[model samples]
Target: MNLFADIRLAVIAALDALVAEGGLPAGLDYANVAVEPPRDALHGDMATNAAMVLAKPAGAKPRDIAEALAAKLGADARIMAAEVAGPGFLNLRLAPGVWADVVRAALKAGAGYGRSSLGKGVKVNVEYVSANPTGPMHVGHTRGAVFGDALASLLDFAGYEVTREYYINDGGAQVNVLARSAYERYREANGLEPEIREGLYPGDYLIPVGEALKAKYGESLLGQPEEVWLADLREFATEAMMGMIREDLALLNVKMDVYSSEKALYGTGKIEAALKRLEDLGLIYEGVLEPPKGKLPEDWEEREQTLFRSSQFGDDVDRPVKKSDGSWTYFAPDIAYHFDKVERGFDQLIDVFGADHGGYVKRMKAAVAALSENRVPLDIKLIQLVKLFKNGEPFKMSKRAGTFVTLRDVVEQAGADVTRFHMLTRKNDAPLDFDFDKVLEQSKDNPVFYVQYAHARVASVLRKAAEAGVDVSDAALGAADLSLNTHPAELELARKIAEWPRHVEIAARANEPHRIAFFLYEIASDLHALWNRGNEEPALRFVQDDAAITSAKIAQARACAVVISAGLGILGVTPAEEMR
Candidate 1:
């Protein structure tokens, strides 16, 4: 259960009682009131701004209202003390039994301990890693994949119906380049000297595709001109590249619910329909854009074209849907793709894009806004680059991925779990340095290792309890006399455990799964601190001389393990059961 929310409700009930007893005003808006961890632990467990937030509206002095509210809250059995601090802020110290109850609740719930219903099961579509179907996924798309996958899992844990999607960039000029590149390999496979010209993909990964083409068409396509084989090779090579991409994503344990093709939207009338809808709403127009504020771009032109009134919806400027040559601009197909999502009736949409695509964010949001009529909100998260290092030196490039490091290369070097957790060590928009040596180091500085060690230590405790002939089953652990776990160090850990549900809702509401990682690190730190103290104090050890005391102590450790497992699940990492 959410102890913070329960406490908040208790505070609300106390305020209601104050109003009823004529101790406060008859009507006061309590929506802005908040109960959160105090800024400093020296004050109390939780601090509420009820008096500070209501003093002006209720036409009463802040200290007077805080003193009155303190009396009402002090009567709660769960709150040991409610003291008015500062001008009006009320700090609360929960009863020792409350922390004990949190530990029991955690053991009872296991992996479901921190799950939240904040999303209310709303339908959400998360589209990510929409890289061009040209080559294997590189480190850039790797960050996007991990961030998006973790975010989708977080939303699912928060009770959202999340659909992971990938929009293939196959309808662009990049696919044609991939086709021509494979053709050179095809010639080489047919025992002819291939022309690996400029602007063609030179990666050796396409050698198999070339050999496959030779197997299928043999000499039939050998003598064909550009017109005859370009279309076929484009389709074939794009398919092969997508297959390779799927394997790359699998290396990181990522699976998309849907893989939409940009080519499919070309002739299906979807583009026309999306634009027609915009046109009917008077958002489509013919206009010439002003030159960029700085120096004009090399390809700048003032030709009039069909544009979407994107500026009306907060875009920097109006965006064009059709080029001057009557061909669909890249924005046209993208608009149609988002319209397709809007028509699917998702309550919300989230797009995970690389930091290089920052320029497209405002316009894309404007398109979704105009298409969904502002009914569906869209959030675009831009993931920054991940720089790889090995022992203070820059990591070498991937031999398989040509210029950039491949996702599979990173996963093969560092296992999937290490890669996922290290990638999220920083926020999505912050630059992360993935040091091969540092990440695998068995030190507390390494957050992944530290957190995993905490979980593994719990496992060790469980094994010891079992060897001691104590019942360590979930039922027994949950039914243990948790009141025995009242040590300050032990209660601090339980208090951290009590904050797990609060963290889940906060992370879900912010749409930032990285927060889960940070919370895991904090809770794991608490667990580790308690573990360290147990080394010096025999009473603090998880395994004791008596079965009842041992059970209570092990229960506390197990509760920490349960929450760590749940957090790691959101991060798509398997919790470490045993340390190497």
Candidate 2:
């Protein structure tokens, strides 16, 4: 029931008819032809660029082709009028019955109304929030978590087989630092004043991990050397940190389908195998990298290293896989991890990283390209920072996290639904300001509140109709005679509802879940505008004196609610039946 898509097909069919009638030459590629909502709603319900796109290709004037295409499209019963606008743009006004059918379709489908098959069930692995297994997730990781989870849900709605994954950074030197920090805490738990060192993690979240360590290893590890206890404590502490991270994610209602370990690639043949695949293609070699372009580091030296020829595959330079010290660089395990992803047979891969990792994008894509021989596509989305404010002032750091705000702190204050919705209010690459006071305020300025209020208002309408003895079930509403919904306000809301499936496809194709939030806000604005109009004209009220009229109006409101619920479901936010 995508009216926009249906109209595009009609326009294409009309162009084909023109070719058949010998009015236009054959083979005028129609791929660029599009039927979309008019820029100005007052102009028409939909607009098409078939004439403008085909004019030059067909060796015809724009207006001439537009007039011919308009005449051909006017024959369709769904299109009430097709008027040529500026320079060959065809604006279309759809029949009222067409809008009525869109409402009926929404009511019939309920939560499944806007689901799309854009991906055709292609397997996509979405790796996100792969923060170091050292401490609780911070505000930065929270944004990535929300964005990734919503993206996974959006892909699922768009018919992609999505796997939500987290890659644990346990093999890095950071985890060894975590081990030393936890050992100090273990000594603290054993009634000794622990050394609060500078390099070790200082968060109180790991104090429990230290206590747990004492419970497991007891005082036997208290006086041992680093070798005797470091490895065991590193494994134990990482597991505890991961457990805490899982709980933090749960607080925001985020869950992962897989958890990959960086440590698992160490001492395994996976890294060697991934590099071997690149080496076989003559992409791996030992060479000296040129000095960096900008200000060179004080200790900068042009030393020979094992490098991957990433420059051939779009990276700025060949990236090193191993350092001069004969140890794997950070890029080595990453290449192996992505190679593992490609080997798992996923058709596509998506990684959600913080904006600081922007420089790593090209190199990572190059690695995946080399590993999959360009067969698998990798899309990396970098989420920017989130600045928090309380009462218009900068929010303070979390005491539990020691220096930064924890995900749990934000969730506990703003709630999971509000936090998730607000996090997506801005584009992923754009910095976001999370104002605690503004987000929770129950005003139209707040998008989350406005959208939720729309759903709640619809529920109120249904309840009032039901109490008045009007049948308000979806089956009844969908079957209602909606011809009475001829008011401009009512019709406009239906127009917005018809755009749901089209918007879903657009957002999913761009891999931008933030678009869904914007769409929801627009639809909610329309719904609120219509609801407020009813106060000025009692006849426009949903619960009319006549049962048939009330049923029709209720049906329209229910359809809007249906789309809102579906959009919220994709965002992992529960729709409110009644806002408290």
Candidate 3:
């Protein structure tokens, strides 16, 4: 039960009653009316803007409307008090029983407590970490992978039919680079000094590909021309690299529903068909673009080329689809790829891109808009960079990836769970500092362990209660006398628990999974606060002298565990049963 929503409904009903009593207009729009937690906890349990929002529309004074609405709301049993505040804001204090009911609801709902249906079964395709299929995923792609996977899980929990996807960049020059790099490995495997040239991937991760090439063809491909062996090696090397990427993603507990290849769109008429569709709509034409504003390239020329009128749909300027040499530009295949997604009948599309791709956002949205005729909406989320630190110093780079760190290196050092949770400690757009020493610290300063410690403490309490001959199973704890939970600290936790459903809808609507991590941290703080208070006042402890009291208190502790488990589940991190 969403107590906040229930209270909003009550406030709306009171406004309707005021209209019936001739205190307000009958037809004032109430869409802007909202009920949320008060900015200050001392204000009240919840606050509503019904009076302030309706005053002008209903042709009534703000305070007058607020007083009338407060009187009507205060008459309800669940509302202990409703006071009209500055300029018609209405603050409400809920009956203590409302919090008790929330605790019981949490126990009954377990892991399903905060699941929402806000998405309403809409099909959303989330494409992320579509890195070039040339090597194993590095630290840059790791952030996208974690963010996308968590978002997919969040949307799924919030009732969206989500498909996790990866678009492979196999049709670009990058694949040809992979082929040449593997050929060197092939020669190296055949006992010859390989030319590890410039402009090609130099990571040792591809050593296996060279070894595999040697096994497949031996010395036959040693003296062949580029044409004779490039095709087979390109296909073979891309598959192997993708395999390694899949393993990297799986290391972080991520799996894509589909892996689309740009190569698959080549020579299949898909690109031509997509451009033709745009051409039929008068969006495609041969034109010359203005030189970039700041600095023009030395070879810049105003040459005629096939272009898409991206500015028609909100891009800064028209963009070239085909170069002057008649070859498809990078944007051409991306347009075709998105067109293929739209044709697959997806109602919505979400692309999670790195912050460097910020320039591509508008043009991509324009492409989807023109292709789908604005029927399908695309949301692009840009994930910023993650800086790593260890022992109060910046984490150094890896020689293997040449200039950057690899995902496996981070995971192997900081561990997957710590890495996942710490990456989400900040919003996607904000910079996050992953300090290896700070994250693993056992103190409350570390959010990951703090949250996990809360769950582990709950398990400890359950074990202690069971050993004391008290029944602590879910069924028994759920049936306990929850009315005994009247302490302010105990009731405050229940109030936080009641906010879960509200938090889920907010995070999902904003497409920010980082909100879940923040909420979990707050919940864990409340749980830990109560645990520490038990030391000062023994009555606040989960295990008590009497069986009835123990059951009631332990039930609340278990309820906290239940919510934490559900939140961690959405984050794809296993909730700890006990701290090692």
Candidate 4:
């Protein structure tokens, strides 16, 4: 079903035959050989570097090997022509029937069309949206949530056993600040003046948490010392914030397989155990770190601390695990968390962090490398900022969140599908601008609407054909004489459909789900182009005077929908059945 893959296999077989016939030397590695769309479409459908890569290894001139490989490939029924280009590159043009077969394959596969087995069912843990348990998720967290959720789904579609996880930052000082803020709100709920002081959360969202706290504890803990109530209220507020975060994620239809608490890492000996493993590996040492490279902090001093030899693996410098005061540094728990993931036997670990965490990437990677002894691979994706705009101006801040725009605000205004799709229009590490009016516009320039419109157009085609008494069922369309689809425009769309499976594997292999959005936009562009052509070209219409031809044409449109729907599913967007 993967046309490019099939063609690559044919090319490999041709090379194998060349080796067998003694036309080429024996024992040449073909692993570096690749077949892909040419940089310029006019060059050919696909271009392979099989000869270019093997010429030196096989001890033959590039031209001679390319000519030999060309002859073998030209004999393939699937390849219409195989010609050698400059420096021994072979350009291949597939037989026209191959594109027709792509339509049949898409129709036969339905929603499973682009699903790939690229990951080989390896266990992958994707941890994202681990926003501090302080308040509602903001727009920044929204981007991370959407990106990570889509990536996990993409990996799963590519046959990875993906686990969506959220690591709660409750053990940090932020949670302590949250407890004090909630305590103030709890006082306000108990009919007293609340101190919404500096360095405290002032979001109106905490008012409800205050009411809940009052209901649970009444006035019994009023006026208690910070020591008496800090721990209890910290736990309480963290849970309350997590409840709101869960609701926020649900608004976007994101559900996690696991929720890990950083506070739990304390008192569980897990952090100590992780460090012990590092110590056993000789990666842990007690020493004074050199003063950091840049401007010295006001409290900077060279003090003895427990450090991890992170630089040995690939970090800017060694990282501290414990402070001079014997308290675990922030890096300690993160290492333990990742160690827990490794111990759980996940084949790979992916951390979705904000752009601000870029500096932590190397050290985190070094830790996982040392702890897992390089058995587990760690990939940390840094999600960049999402700037919000309405019309042409910056969107106002969320009063509920007290500073930034809340995830709920964005989702409620634009709806989940629009928000998710628009968020992915750019790379994860690139900044994105979410303009409410632009994304909801019913224009082809808007990818969200454009892609959805393609699916809806296919739906419209099916409805029209069905009303005209054409057998538009998948079985009937798949059984249609697809060879009747002879129009160049129609076959071009089929060719695009054929690229879906290949693009899925490519996107999944790169761990970049945004590429799926990019591919969806491209294929949608092809569908829209063909749909427009139908307006002036009657023969290109989906519903024709002849029911059989109508079935044939509608098969192509349905095939378009099949790949579009499958792609949108990976992005967690519902394929629109009709355009509004």
Candidate 5:
């Protein structure tokens, strides 16, 4: 129900009354007026700058405006007090019934309690996990995958039509490396000692790809030269690697809506079409770029190359699309791919890149700006590194991914739900530490367990109530006389439940999914605190001696569980029904 928005609307209506009664100017701009939580909750539930923002424009003192505004707002049924504080801030405290209504609203709305219409169904494309199809996904790519998937879900919850996409980097030297790597596996399948060359992939994961090639070809590609079997084996090996990647994502419950291959764009005139559109707009030209700031490449030479006028769109300098040798640089297909996305009529595009790709953000944004004619906006989120630990020691590397820890290794150790939730516990641009020991710990220090433990605790209460012959269905709980829950601890939880819808909008507007994680943690903390409180005072417990009073209080606690479950659902984490 967005209680904050409801209160803000009431405040605005009172201000409108002030203008109508001739106490204020005729058409004062109220856009700057805001109703939000007080800096210190000790002040009140919400505070607004209605007085100060209007004081300068109205040629009146802030106290005069605040005093006049307070009298009008004091009459609203929901507002218990509208006291003017420091300068012109209007601090408000809503009645206990207001918080009580929030609990009822949560039970009625269920998991869809915080779903918003902020995006209004705008089309958005999210590109993530664009790793080369050379091997299994590693820890770095895992963060990107989890971040992007959670972002897409968050946007969808905020009423955006989100499309999860993956760009396959098969149109480069990496795929050729995959081909050569598979060629050795092919020989290995032929009962010969395969040479694990210095540059070739040395992972044992390709052993199965070797075995699969033998079954498919059956001596057809035996003893073949590089040119003879390169193309066939490259396609096969790439598919096998992608299959493994899909399985890895499936473990974390991440599913992509689309998978775009860079190789599919080559030789199809798509690159020419996209670049020609830019050229016609005077964005593409043949030029020589100044050498990068400090150390230059050993073979750095000034040569004319095809370039994009990225500087016009806010990049540091014009970027090269084609190298001096007339071959397409790595950015050529990227431009075409983004252009394709722009042509698909998406209102916005978002790219989740690793922190190492920070340098490419500006140029990529510039390309989208030029290609979309400044109509579409692009947001590139750079996910910082993840450091893994076990019992406070660094986790060892995986032999499958050949170097770093693979996503499968982490999932195998911590399980998919723990891995996903722990990965998202930090901001996308901040470093995250995934400690196997800490995550699996069943204490309040572990957020994943704490949140799940809250849900499971609620389940235990419901089961106990059912065994005692009490009807604990959501309909019954929502319909219970929750006015009996007048304890301060119970009221505080109800107030927190009221903040969910507003928090959803704030989190969606900032594009920060971590805020959702933080909110869920706070909700769990409040619930757990109340649970602990009951241990001291038996009267505050869920199952009281009186069945009717028990239903009233248990309903309030169950409502809190409903909101937590919904929030965790948006984050793609499974709420524990019972802690093991």
Candidate 6:
């Protein structure tokens, strides 16, 4: 039901016929040949580069090949006209029946209309929102959470077996700091003055964790030394923090399929095994790294360490796996985690990180490459910062988080659906300004509202049609004589509907879920434009005098709504049945 893909295939078939007839040279690669919408819709419904792409390879002139291809394509019933423009591009005008069929296909497919099998069910692990088990997720993690969740849904729509994962940073020194901070809170629960140290987590969110520890250990851990209580408190506080993080993610409708712990890889021989694999490949060595190019750290010195030859796999330099102090560097556990993923037999891996982690990208990818022996591909997406504003002014920080706005604050203000949709209005690497005033505004300026309003409008039409005794069920609409939808405005909206399948494939292939939001906005614009046009031309209205005509028009509107709902689903936003 993908009109564009079908037309591209037809173009390819025509080229193969040319080769068979000896009109073009044999064995010309047609991979680059494409059929897409013409730049100017006035020119035609579709355009193809079959002639231009094959001209040099076929040892023929562009115009000569285009003329022949045009003649061949014009004979097809679906293509009403095939005119060569700009030397070799063939612009095609499809018959009205073709556009009608697009509407029918959409109604029959419903929300499944745009689903694609591009990934062929390949297992893909999408690790995102891997915030440390220290506190509730903040605004930065919210952006990554929404982006990664939407991407997983997008990949699922495109037929990838997606596993949403969260890599907990519990194995690091940060968790120990969290433990010490919680111990202070525990002392506070026991009527002691808690020392809020400068380097410790200062968020009041841990106050509850202290109460819980007191409930479990009574007064036993209150006066214990660091060595005696540190490990137990770290484990207890890490669990509490994760519970809070899970609650925060639930507020934003984010759920992870896997929660991997960095600490689990310790003493399990996993890190040693991952490094051993690299060592067997001659990628691991004991070496000294040159001092960083720019201003060096005050403690910087050339020291021998266990390093991975990351530069061999396109990193800036070799990366250390172990420090001079005989402890595992931060990168080592990450490598082991990825190695575990590779052993789990995923076909692809994607990591959504904060923009500040950009420097870690190349080295991480290099580690995966060396560990997987280039058998697997890893993609890391860096999500930029989100600037929150309220009433056109900068929003204040959350007192609970102490330093930043928590995810719950954004969700509570805007609601989950609005926040998710607006978060995806910009590319992951582009800064987004979330203005509470602007996003809730019921105007075209608000993409979320505009798109939802389009869906609600179609729902209203369907309800009115049903009340008017017009059979508007999907089966009836799909079988309606949609040739009645021949008006230019109606056909234009149908053309946009036909682009849905192709758009889904493109967005999924690019791993850019933002494109889905953009597509939804474009199609919503088209729906709104056509709806407005009906005001002046009563015949363009969905509820026409004739039942058949009304059914056909309603069918088209329903089709557009179907695609909108599907796209919204991919974005992790629920389509509005009616906007309140």
- Tens-place lDDT per residue, model 6, 136-239, is 89999999999999999999999999999999999999999999999999988988999998999988999999999889988898667899999999999999
| Model 2 Cα lDDT, one tens digit per residue, 247-296 | 99999899999999999999989999999999999999999999999999
**Residues 219-338, model 3: lDDT tens digits:** 999988999999999999999989999999989999999999999988999999999999999999999999999988999989999999999999999999999999999999999999
Which candidate wins on lDDT? 2
The collision pairs in model 3 are: none
- What's model 1's overall lDDT? 0.92
* RMSD for each of the candidates: 1.2, 1.0, 1.3, 1.0, 1.5, 1.1
TM for every model, in the order presented, reads 0.98, 0.99, 0.98, 0.99, 0.97, 0.98
Candidate 2 TM-score, C-alpha based: 0.99
lDDT of 1 by residue, 1-580 (tens): 9999999999899999988988888878889898999999889899999999999988899999999999988888999999999899999999999988898888888888888888898999999999899999988888899999999999999999999999999999998899999999999999998898889888889999999999999978887898899999999999999999999999999999999999999999999999999999999999898998988899887899999999999999999899999999999999999999999989999999999989999999999999999999999999999999987999999776668888888888889999999888888999989899999999999999999999999999898778879899989998989999878888889889999999999999888998999999999999988888988998898888988999999998999999999999999999988999
Model with the higher lDDT, candidate 3 or 6: 6
lDDT of 4 by residue, 150-177 (tens): 9999999989999999999989998889
- Screening candidate 6 with a backbone cut-off below 3 angstroms (N, C-alpha, C), the clashing residue pairs are none
Candidate 1 clashing pairs, residues 3+ apart or interchain = none
* CA lDDT scores, all candidates in order: 0.92, 0.94, 0.91, 0.92, 0.91, 0.93
Question: What are the per-residue Cα lDDT tens digits for candidate 5 across 494-538?
Answer: 888888888888888777888889998998999999999999999
For candidate 3, report its TM-score. Answer: 0.98
Regions of model 2 farther than 4 Å from truth: none
